[model samples]
Target: MRATVDFAPLFRSSVGFDRMLNALDLASRIPTVDNWPPYDIVKTGEDDYRIDMAVAGLAENDLTITQERNTLVVTGRKAQEPQSAAEYLHRGIAGREFERRFDLAEHMKVTDAHFENGLLSITLKREIPEAMKPRRIAITSSTTRAEEAVPQIEARKEAA
Candidate 1:
C-alpha cells in the first residue's frame, strides 16, 4: 500500500523547499525501481558523508561518477567481451549497466571516490561558505556609547 501526501499546502508557505518536497513526492511514486546493486549511505562526521555501493565484477574503468548542481550520478557499464564464445554454466555476479542518482543538499560536494574489494566508496563533504556561516555580533550598551560621546563633545567645544 502506498500513501499519498499532498504538498500543495506546503508549497504555499515554503519558499526554497520545492525541490526537496518534489523529490520526496517523486520517490514515493516510484516503488518498482530495481535495487540490483546494494548501497549504503553513512554520515562519517558532522559535515561528511560516504556512500558505499556493491559493484562486483566491475573495475574502476567500468564506472563513472558525475555531479551536476545538487545531483550525484553514478553509472556502471561493463566492457564488452572479446570476440570469443564462452558459455557459463551458472552466472551469479551481475555486470549489467546501472545508473544511480542521489539528490544532495546545497553546498555538498563529492570529494573522492575509490573502488576497493568490489566496493565503491564515494566521499562527500558539506562546505558552507564563510559568509553564510553563523556569526556572533557583539552588542554594546547605551551608557558606554554616551561616555564615548562626552570626549568628542569636549574636543568640539575647544575648537569652537
Candidate 2:
C-alpha cells in the first residue's frame, strides 16, 4: 500500500507563508514521480531534532546543502559518464539529479551536519529565550491571607 496526501485544500486555503511553506511545497512535489532517497526525521530531545537523508552514490562535492530563512534545501547531481562504452544488462538503482527542501520551525537552528555511509545527518536545536521559558510562581502568604479576609458591612439608619 502507498500513502497519499491531498494538498488541494492547502492550495485553496489562504495560509500565511513565511519562506518555509514555499520550500515545503516544492519538496513535496519533488517526490511526485519517484521517491528516490528515503529519509527520516527524529526528535532527539526536548528541543533537538535530526534529519537523516539517504544519499548513496553521491559525493560531498556533488551534493550541496543550503538554508535560507527557515528553509533547508538539498540538491545533488550525479556526474555524467565519461563515455558509454559497454551496454548495460540491467539497471535497478536510480542515480539522477534531485533537489529536496524542508521547512524549519521558528527558533530551530541547524547545529551540526555530517555525512557518513551514504547517509546525510543534520542536527537541529530549538533554543527558547529566557522570557519564553516556563516560569514557576512562588506562593506567598499575602495572596493566601487576602482570600481568607471577610467583608465588613456598615449599619444604615432610617431617615425621617
Candidate 3:
C-alpha cells in the first residue's frame, strides 16, 4: 500500500516554495529507471557529508562531476574505442553511460573528491556566511547612561 500526496491545495496558497515542492515531488518519485552504478550517502560529521559511488571499471577521464548552484551532476561516459576481436561468452559489467543528479542544500560546498579502490568519494561541507549566521545582540539596561542627542538649531526667517 502506498500513500499519495497531493500538492494541489498547497500550490494554491503557498508562494516562493516551488523549489521545495518540486524537490518533494522528485523525492516521492524516486523509483525511476536506470539505477546503474550504485551510490551511498553518509553523514560523517555535524556539517559534513560524503557520497561514495561504486564506479568500477571506469577511468578518471570517463567521469565528470560538476557543481552548479545547489545541484550536483555526476556523469559517466565511456571512451569510444574499436570493438575487441575477442569473443566473450558472458558479459556482466555495465558499460552504458549514465548521468545522476543530486540536489544539495544551501551553503553546501564540495570539499574534495578522490577515486580509490573502484570507489569515488565526494566530500561536502556546509559553510554558512557570517551575515547569514545567527548572532547575539547585547542588551542594555534602561538605567545605563546614554549618549547626548544633538540639538537642531532653528532657521532664521528671511525678509520677503
Candidate 4:
C-alpha cells in the first residue's frame, strides 16, 4: 500500500492560500534566515509586543529605527575612527554595521523604542478601537422585558 497526500483542499479556498504562495516566494529569496544580532520577541499582553535586538557596542546615535510602508527598519552603523594612531593585532568583535527589517501587520504601529545597555528595545502596540475589539453579544430570549414594568397609560399621563 502507498500513502497519498492531499493538497487540493488547501487551494479550494482563497483565504490564506495567496499568503502561503507569497511566503514561499519570499523564502526562496533569502538563502538563510539566521538571526545576526540575536533578538527576542516577547508578548507583553494582548495587542502589545516588544522586540529586543542585541546590538552591542552601538551607541544611541549609531542606531536608527523607522517605519516605512508597514515595515520596521532598524539600521546601525558604527562611528568611524581615525586610524592614524590605532593599530590592532587581532580584532574579532562584530561591531561593524548591520540593518534589520521587520514586517509590520496592519494597524500595528510602533509606540516607542529605546536603546539601553547595548540592547535595542522596540515596543509595538496595536491600536484596536472599541468596535474593533472582540465583543460578546448578549443573547436575548423571545420574551420582552419591561424597563420598569410601569403601565403605559400612567407613563403617558405623567408625561402630560
Task: Give the Cα lDDT of each candidate.
Answer: 0.92, 0.80, 0.88, 0.79
lDDT at residue 66 of model 2 (Cα atoms): 87
Clashing pairs in 4: none
lDDT of 4 by residue, 1-160 (tens): 4344444566575576665556555655566655678889899999899999988877899998999967899998999965777788887667768888887776788999998898999999988677888999986654645444655554344553
lDDT of 3 by residue, 1-160 (tens): 5567888788789998898888887777676677878999999999999999998878778899999999999999989967989998997877668898989998999999999877889999999999999999987765553554558899999999
| lDDT of model 1 at position 11 | 87
- Is candidate 1 or 2 superior in TM-score? 1
- Model 4: weakest 10-residue lDDT segment is 1-10
Regions more than 4 Å wrong, model 3: 8-18, 29-31, 145-160
TM-score of each: 0.87, 0.61, 0.80, 0.69
lDDT of 2: 0.80
What TM value does model 1 have? 0.87
Clashes of each: 0, 0, 0, 0
- Candidate 2 per-residue lDDT, tens place, 118-137, comes to 88898999987899889999
